[model samples]
Target: MSGRDLLQTQLERGIAALGTSLPGGAVARLLDYQELLHRWNSAYNLTAVRDPAEMVTRHLLDSLAIIPFVEGATLADLGTGPGLPGIPLSIAAPEREVTMVDSNGKKVRFLREAIRSLKLTHAHAVQSRVEGVEGSFDCITARAFASLADMLGWGGHLLARNGVWLAMKGRHPAEELDGVPPGFRVEGIHLLNVPGLDAERHLVVIRREG
Candidate 1:
């Protein structure tokens, strides 16, 4: 099989392992996004996982694994370096409005190019500190961006009423739970089983309380 074929097979199998279905052309777009990231990564160093196949497992599948938890029409991916879950989620669910937020100029530039090239009509990129970003979102996602306390402290105000906050962490963050700051409560912590990835993954679900 060719390299492209391998990537396709890997992505397909990983999607199947997740037991979820994506819209038609989603797989193709995802591969295209991966290719774009790979090419840009050569000069920009977007991510450390350099292999395409590994990108399928680590970047693509890992992001898709939280699809079930992601709700609401508007989503803000804070500290979204290279648009991880934001880009993939937008490709998978074209209807959701996704905003990829990052402080780094290069990453935001790459995100804009990806949005344009991928034709992600509902996705937008903003180069600003997470706390500085404006607008309320139905859902917020931060992938290992910062500690729970710090993330919620800085960007908690951006979450709309009854909005869900999904924080992706490598391990079960028991210690950080206490640091979740006031006005926010831990709803649940879900373990993510990403295909072809043998590492620990946890999604901490939080919500604003009255």
Candidate 2:
């Protein structure tokens, strides 16, 4: 099989493994985004992961794993270096308004191009630090961006009153639990089962304390 076919098969299997059904044409769009990412990474060094199959696992599947936890109509992916979860999630669920925020100009440029080329009407890219980003969102996602404390300290204000904060961590961040800042509490830490990914993946869910 050709490389693109292999990648498509891997992605389809991974989605099936996750037991999540994406809308028609979503998978194709996701692959298109991945291809764009691969092309840009060569010159811009956007991400550390380079292998196509690994990208399907670590980037695409890893991002889709959190689809079950994502809620609300608006989502802000802070520190979205290359729109990992945001872009994928936007493709899967075209109804949500996704804002991919990042400080890197090159990454943001790529994001814009992907949005236009993929016809992602609900997704947009913003070049700014997480703290500098304005407006509240129904859901906020931070993946490998910063420590729990620092991430919340800088961008906590962006979460709406009833919004949830989904912090994607590598492992169970037991030590950082205490440093989650006041007013917010850890609701749950879900173990993400990313297909073809053996490493530890945890999703720390936080919300305003009632």
Candidate 3:
């Protein structure tokens, strides 16, 4: 089979593994986004993961694993290189407004094109540092962008009261939990089961303490 076909198959398998009940066309759009990412990575170097099949497991599935933890109507993906979790989450939850923020020019351009090409009207790309972003979001996602403390330090103000901050990490970050900001508290740390991904993946759920 051709490479794209193989990728489609892999993505379908991964989605089934996640056991997510998504709207129709969600899987197709994710495959399309990955294709666009692979094409652009040839020159722009958007992500380090090069193999298409691996991208299915590492990027797409890894991103979708956090879908269950998301809450509320708006989400902001900080340091969203190549729009990893942001684009996928936006596709899955089209009703929610997803804003992908990044400081890199090329990555932002790629994200815009993907959003337009994939017809993701609810998702928008912004070019700025996390600290410079404006407005509050009900859910904010940071995918290994920085330490839990530093990420909350830079973009913590953007989270709406009672909102949840979903931080993706490679391992259980026991040490990183030591310095969570004053307003936010560690609500939960759930382990992720990403099909075909061997490395440890955990989602750190932080919410503003009442």
Candidate 4:
């Protein structure tokens, strides 16, 4: 089956598992993103998940799982390689401004293309390290970016006073929280049941106490 066909099937499976209605526009945007990723992956080597079916589970559904927690907020996706949670989040919540940051120039290029293709007015891709980018955000998200402690060290400064950091992890990160930085405090740890993927998922929300 073609990539688009596979994506459609996977999206159906995801919709069933999520048990929530996906925005009509989201389906088209996700298909477009998969097509672009497939085209770019040949040259840019953006993501390891080349199969469209896997992209739906690993990228689309996995990102969508956090939508309920991401209401209307200015979000920054640190280390957004090929715009995993960032691009998908932008598609799901068009009103929310999303900035996708990545250190890899090629991946940023692909992200920008996807943004343009999707006509995402509220989304932009930045080619820079997390620390180099300025401006505080209401919600900051990262997927497979770094360890909890490392993310806190670099991305902690980019969050607004009452902002929240939603870090996506594969497993419970209780042990990694032992040496958290001084300014931030863990508000909650949510176990995310992502659709179409069997991997363990956790959303760690942190906020600055002072």
RMSD, one per candidate, in order: 0.7, 0.9, 0.9, 1.7
Summarize candidate 2's per-residue lDDT along 118-185 as a digit string, tens digits: 99999999999887899989999999678999999999999998789999999889989999888898
Model 1 residue 167 lDDT score: 98
Question: After aligning candidate 2 to the native by TM-score, how far in Å is the CA of 47 from where it should be?
Answer: 0.8
Q: Rank the candidates by TM-score, best first.
A: 1, 2, 3, 4
- Which is the winner by lDDT between candidate 1 and candidate 4? 1
How high is the CA lDDT of each candidate model? 0.94, 0.93, 0.93, 0.85
Candidate 4 lDDT by residue in tens digits, 46-105: 888988778888888888888777744799999989998999888888888999999998
Off by over 4 Å in 4: 1-6
Over the stretch 38-142, how does candidate 1's per-residue lDDT look in tens digits?
999999989998999999999999999999999999999999999988999999899999999999999999999999999999999999998789999999999
Give model 4 RMSD, 1 decimal.
1.7
Alpha-carbon TM-score of each model against the true structure = 0.98, 0.98, 0.97, 0.93
Count backbone overlaps in model 2: 0
Superposed by TM-score, candidate 4 places the C-alpha of residue 126 at a distance from the truth, in angstroms, of 0.8
How many backbone overlaps does candidate 3 show? Answer: 0
Candidate 2 structure lDDT: 0.93
Q: Using alpha carbons, what is the TM-score of model 4?
A: 0.93
Q: Highest lDDT: which candidate? A: 1
